[model samples]
Target: MTIEHAVPADQAADLVRQLYRAFLARDPGDGEVAVHIANMQHDGAMAAVSDIIYSQEALSVRAHAEPARPSLPEGMLAISRADIAEVVAYALEAARHDAPSAYEVELRVDDVGRGTPLAVVLRDALQPPQLPQESVEDDASINRTIEIMYRMALGRMPGPADLENWRGAAGNGGRLSNVVFGIGESAEAKLIRGAFDVVPGIKVQLAFEIVLGRGAAAAEVDHFRRMVDKQGSDISPLVWQLFADEARRRLLPPQHANDPHLAYIFGSRGAVTLADWRTGKKAVAKTAIKHDVLGFESVVRLRPAEDCVVSILTSLYRGGAFIRSFLENMTSQTIFRTHCELIIIDANSPENERAVIEEFCRDFPNIVYKRMDARVGIYEAWNIAAEMAKGRYLTNANVDDIRRNDSFEIQAALLDTLDFVDVAYQDVLYCFEPRLPFEEIAKRDFRSDLPVVSRYNLMEFNSPHNAPMWRAALHRDVGPFNQSLQSAADFEFWLRCRAAGKIFYKVNEAHAAYFVNPDGMSTRPDTRGAVEAYAVSRELYRKIVSPMLVISDEEFLARVDEIDAAPLREGRRYDIVQSALLALGTRREGVVA
Candidate 1:
């Protein structure tokens, strides 16, 4: 390889040893260099250089060595080792920069061995500070230009001996650009540039170099250039279309024609309010569940059908972190793939969640994605998704929540077996760490704190837990969730259902895990907002359900102490309508208790 032959073997060995010591802060193990040298002969010297500088040992040492450093610079990718390694590997393999010198590699040790983002380092490597343009006939002027280039490129002034060596080259009629090019292409510079995450423009540039085997002509396709710019980091779709053997027209899988359950699939992106969404207005983006690709190794079997038993409504806002968990959890359901429909409404998240959603939408045929032009409340988004639901049953899906793989099967079977039950809620396991995969979480110690929804328990707290599956017919009878309240909207809706004489069945199993993150709305340190919302919802509940009770609101309120002292029962049912009214007093401004 060019890198292996760039310098004499003895000089290259010194550079590699310096790399191991500086990057990993340790001496190489016995025979490690020999192994890397073998790899160098097979792949290239840079590959061996990369193997040492970006190895797991290097990353771990750097991370622990500087725990007190300021957190990663804002706007950079989270310092995931895998992500960094992948991007750096690709850049190292594809970039055509000159091989670096041993001295330059030693000089860059601090920058490369710290928490500095690889992107920043790579950007610097690709575009180093320019050398000063000056007449090179005189020794004094050449010395000035060489010293400046050394300082800017290597972050230090040139030593006396180095100055003499560079000056001799300059005295021999070497151009300033040529004199400084070595410092810019030094080992340090190449290593830094290799770790940078490739931008869209660079991706296009790399594709030209690797696939087309030539630099892109200015007259090249403008559409592809625009596509790269728009796609940002993920250029695979564009790459496949532009360079792969596959036909460009078939780049995306075929979408369903006139899908009855979806509002829009093939249309321009735009915004719609919750009301507009309910009215069948065009969504900013959408994809049908039945027309997309199937997920590999999914436990759920494919059951292709036009109809489904349950429609899962997921309202996403700032949920980019939970997308992977959400998809994995949803697709792991024991029911056949087509037995349920997943409806996701994106609330104009600032994060580019739509890209991930679109990519997965192509894999999971049950995912029906819709994006709102603007942010909306969770309830508002749920209502919008509910409007487009085409199943017999409906459930709101929290993107960050976890459930057993058979949780859906259990709940759906409950509803199917008990035709009288309009709503089915199961015990929920509340835990600090709910981000673990469902299988792992299922093995955890489960605390079944949620009880059968007695009108009493629902009054005291949210008994249905967020994972309840309810009949879609309830929405037709009782209407969509209340948009007025934020925290207590679900509670208010459940009370409204109870007042409308809808029966709720509680499954005794704790298959659903409710994440109790401190930052969560209900779990935050200051719960005044939730308290006030609860008060308002209780007042609304009193107004809706008080007339349906035989006892007055005050009489029902009098039994608060009695109910608090009652013995806890796992299977006990509390059905008295008087229990629906909150014992806590309501205020004009809404009370905390």
Candidate 2:
């Protein structure tokens, strides 16, 4: 076929600009456009196109395109000058080849001396007589194959275990390409592909996924895209810091945990050993570590420790969606720093709660983060956090729930002053969305009504508030919350406390906010699961209180029915409960009302 030649300078410039954008993901500078235009006029369009595409810049861009090495801080290069030169030279040589050649070109550290030019080293390495006919599975070839797979799939170098595992797989008749595909197809590796996302929000979400094992919240996505637009900051450092934080938390798997390229990430971030981490001694190194590793620039500064007074226990499961709001509620509290400590027990949550939690932990000193290796029931997580509580008073904090800014202060003050009250339960403001401020939500709809929850009202239903502050000694008195119950554990515990003569006082104000989420355990579309869980809890409660009860099981349940049928006292309303019932009824009728 005959080729048409470019004639006009404008056409040539347009072609060059398109090539720059297509190959380099950027517009060509004025000077670059002029040079390429001149080249095209003199050498023709095809030659110009070849030169632009085969240029060192284009080659480097393509070589590092997928899973781009996360940006480094302070313009620090991920590799040494010599290593970078070698890589560029290798890429240049590989791209220059128009067709397959008999000679194989490769560069090894042992082939070049210090200060030797990369061109000279490659020239020597490419010599057919000097090149060794190494088998594809040889040590050098396998190492190279492993490195290529890791760089492509994980955006980092393979660790010792990674190398060993891949080598074993290759030796066991596994093809090197298959190993590459295997690594590339893994869930972890899939997250690393965020570098290629054109949408900033998708990129941010992918970064969160890789670093935190969960997608980014909507607010986080918006915040990061703004950073890219206003500040012109690269998201790589954010992703890198996330990785560093994950490593600091020891949340990474063994392969990544032991990666030598990522070793500096842990070293700089004040990472502690497993034993120290378990004992709540994270962030031992307070100062920022300035040393640059392959993927990280500098370590994040961590907040100093705070004195514990009120232990806020949060059990996280599928709570990734609520992390931002939950942390805001806790940190915004007036006594958050002075009197409250948040102990988060993540029961192997399926979402990326750890990343969000650790990010907040850097600024909030009272956060205690712990991860469970396997999924556990909600009550089990609460029990775990309760035992880990260090404050004088402890309160159960659900990940999806929020309270007023002075909620902690109010609850703590009640417990601190009222020596007669062993447990203080406050009225709750119920809302559909916890993201909105409770005060704002109350203007449109509100629910705050809990009659004195004595042993009498307790038989009808668990009237004790969901988020209650009680003396830490009460845990010893009533023992930990019943781990056996799901939706009704708190109820059984309240019954236990009442039977043990523990006084429960109801605070006048609605300080706590309950988010009636449709997907929540108690508020899901199906009520059968919660009802069955309550059934189990009711049986257990009856057994625990039977010895001290004056009524039989039938009479107790009958009294509960009576309490349900009783009219509300003056100025008392269960707006939250009524709303829940309305939603439940609507769902049963196949309507969203």
Best by TM-score: 1
Candidate 2 lDDT (Cα, 0 to 1): 0.58
Clashes of each: 4, 0
The alpha-carbon deviation from the true structure for residue 417 of candidate 1, after best TM-score superposition, in angstroms, is: 1.3
Residue by residue across 1-593, what tens digits does model 1's lDDT show? 12222334544454445456555556666588667756665544544666775577766765576311111121233322322333343233223233343223323333454666444544443343478777536777767666756654555688889889987776676766677787667786566445535544445545554553433322232223433443333354344434532232246564433222221111122222224323432332343212111235433333334778889988888787888778878888877385888999988988878888778778777789998988788889889988998888898778778877777777777777677999988766544454676544444334455556654345545667569999999988989887766666787788788768788887766777766555555545543444555354434443332221322223433453354422321111233322322322223226543
Off by over 4 Å in 1: 1-306, 526-529, 541-593
Off by over 4 Å in 2: 1-306, 527-593
Residue-by-residue lDDT tens digits, candidate 2, 370-489: 999999988888888888888888888887887877777767766666679888886665555448765554443244556776644564445564788888898888788768656767
Task: For candidate 1, report its TM-score.
Answer: 0.41
Most accurate candidate by lDDT: 2
RMSD (Å) per prediction = 26.1, 26.8
In angstroms, give how far residue 414 of model 2 lies from its true place: 0.6
Estimate the TM-score for candidate 2: 0.40
